[model samples]
Target: MTKIVLYARVSTADQTIEHQEAQARSAGFMIDEVVADKGESGLTTRLSERPEGRRLFDMLRDSDVLVVRWVDRLGRNYADVCDTIREFMRRGVIVRTVINNMTFDGATKDPMQQAVRDALIAFMAATAQAQAEATKEAQKAGIDHAKAAEDGRYLGRKPSFTTEQFQRVHDMLSQGAGVSMIAKSTSLSRQTIYRIKDNPTESAAALASWGL
Candidate 1:
C-alpha cells in the first residue's frame, strides 16, 4: 500500500496545521499521516533543516507519496526547492502538491518525458521563489508604512471590517479560501476582501489606527 503523508510549514499566525490538512483533504487527498513544522519560515529554512522536515527525510519510504500545500513548503528558494523535490523523486517517493495537483516522479526512464518533467519542476520552483520574494517585499513595505503612520495623524477612511473580521479574513485566506468564499462566509464585499488580500498589513494598520 502507498502511504500518503501531508507536510505543512506554518509561518504565520493565520496559518495552522489543521488548515493545511483541511486544504489537502478538500483537494481529494486521503492523507494517511501529517507532519508539520510551526514557526518555520520557508523563506529562510531548508526542508532538511526543519525538525519535522528532517523527520520526513528519515521517515518517508520508497513508493510512499508526500503531499504539500505547494512546492514552496519544501524549501527556501528555487534551487533548494528543486533540489529537495529531485532528492525525493530519486528516492522513489512520489511528490505531489494540492494547489495545482502537481506530481513529480523519478520512475520515468524516457528522456523526453524526463525533460518535460524537469522543465516543469524548474518553472514551478522559480515561481515559488518569486512569490516568496514578493511576499517578503510586501511585508517590508507594510512595516515601513506602519512606522510612518505612527506620528498620530489619521491616514484615511477607517476600514469597513472590524479587527475580528480582519483576523477571520486572514485565517480564511491562509487556508486557501477564495475571495468569493470569504466574502460569502464573512458577509464582506468582494472589494473589501480584495483590499484585505492585497494589502493585509495596511488593512490591519487601518484597523489599529481607528482603534477597531
Candidate 2:
C-alpha cells in the first residue's frame, strides 16, 4: 500500500508545522502522520532526543517509506545523519526527499553507482553538519552583539507569555493539570510549560502575583 511517514522539525519557534505541511503538500504527498521535533536545536541531539522523533522510529516497520523536506531535516551531524539513514535503509526502509525527489536505495547492484551514491551522501551530510555549526556561531555573534547594546539579552526562545503568563502555568501545574493540557489551555508550547514549572520562584518573583 506504500505506507508513508513525514517528519518535520523546526530548530526555532518562528518555523511552524504549517510551513512544512505546505511544502509537503506541494510535493504531491499526503502525509500519513507527521512527527515534529519542536524547539530542539542541538546538532548532537539525535532523533531519540526529540519526544516525537523517537516515537517515529517505533512506528516505522520494514518497507515503510519516510519522507522529509531535505536531508538536513533528519540531522545536522555527518556521522549521526548518515549512520541513521543507513540503519533505516538496512531495515528495508526507503528514505526520500521532497526537495529534489532524491531517493537512496541500497539494493542497487551497480558498484560504481553505489560508490557515487555513498560519496554524495557523505558530501551532503558534511554540508549539513557545517551548516549547523555555522548557525551556532552566527547565533553566538548575535547574542554578543545584543548584550553589547544592552537590549535585554536572553538565550533561546523567549517565553511567549512573559513572567505573568509563566506564573499562570506554574499555578496550573501545581493544580495537577498535565503539561499538555496546560499548554492547550494556555496556548503555550509544552516546553514552555515545563520551563515555567521548573522555575516557579524566579518566575513568580519576576512579576506581581495574580493570586492564584
Candidate 3:
C-alpha cells in the first residue's frame, strides 16, 4: 500500500504537529503517519540531521506520498530543499505541498515535462530560501534601529527562556548533549535550544532586550 506521510518542522514551541496534519487532512489527504521536528530551525539544521527528519526519510518508500505545509518545511536553503525533494522523487515517492497544492513526481519521461518540473522546483526552493533570509534581515534591521535610538536599551523580542534556563541549555550544548536531552532537562522546546546553541549572540540580545 502507498502510505501518506506528513512531515512538519516548527522553529518554535507554539507550532504543533497537529496543525500541519490538520491542514493536510483538510486538503483531503489521508495521512498514515506524521513525523515532526519541534524547536528545530530549518535555517540551521539540515533535514537529514534532524531526529524526526531522519525518521521521515527512512520511512518513505517507493510509491509513497509525502506531504508538507510547504517546501520551507523540508529545508530553509535552496540547494538543500531542492536536493531533498529530488532525492525523494528519484526514489519514486510523490511530494506535495498544501500551500499551493503543488505536486512533484518523477514518473515523467518526457523531456519537456522534466524541464518544467525541474524549473518549478528551483523557483520554489529559491523563493523559500529568499523569504527566510529577508525575514532575518528585517529582524536584524529592527534590532539595529532600536539599539541606535535607545542607546542599546531597546531590546528585541522578549526572551522565550529565562536566563537560568538558558545557561543550563548553553552548558548542556557545550557538554555535547543532544538537543532532545537538553530539551527534556530544561523544559525548553528544541527550537529555542537550537537558537541558543546556534546563535548565542542573538539569544543574548533577546535576553538583554527583555532586561533579564
Task: Give me the candidate number with maximum TM-score.
Answer: 1
Candidate 3 residue-wise lDDT, 1-212, digit = tens: 99998998877554667767887898899889888888887777889999999987788999999999788889878888988999999999999997668899999999999999999899888777775665565446545654655765645568789765664565445445699988986789999998877776677557545555
Range of the 10 consecutive residues with the lowest summed lDDT in candidate 2: 203-212
Point to the candidate with the largest lDDT: 1
Scored against the true structure, residue 49 in model 3 reaches a CA lDDT of: 91
Pairs clashing within candidate 1: none
Instruction: Return the TM-score for candidate 1, rounded to 2 decimals.
Output: 0.80
Residue 202, model 3: Cα distance from true site in angstroms: 18
Candidates' lDDT values, in order? 0.81, 0.68, 0.79
Q: 121-170, model 1: which lDDT tens digit per residue? A: 99877767766665565555655666778788766896798654665566
TM-score of 2: 0.67
Q: Per-candidate TM vs. native?
A: 0.80, 0.67, 0.69
| Predicted structure 1: lDDT | 0.81
Candidate 3, after superposition: displacement of residue 181 in Å? 40
Q: Candidate 2: how many backbone clashes?
A: 0
Q: List runs of model 3 lying over 4 Å from the truth.
A: 149-212
RMSD of each: 4.3, 13.4, 11.8
Clashes of each: 0, 0, 3
Q: How displaced is residue 160 in candidate 3, in Å?
A: 19
lDDT of 2 at 43: 80
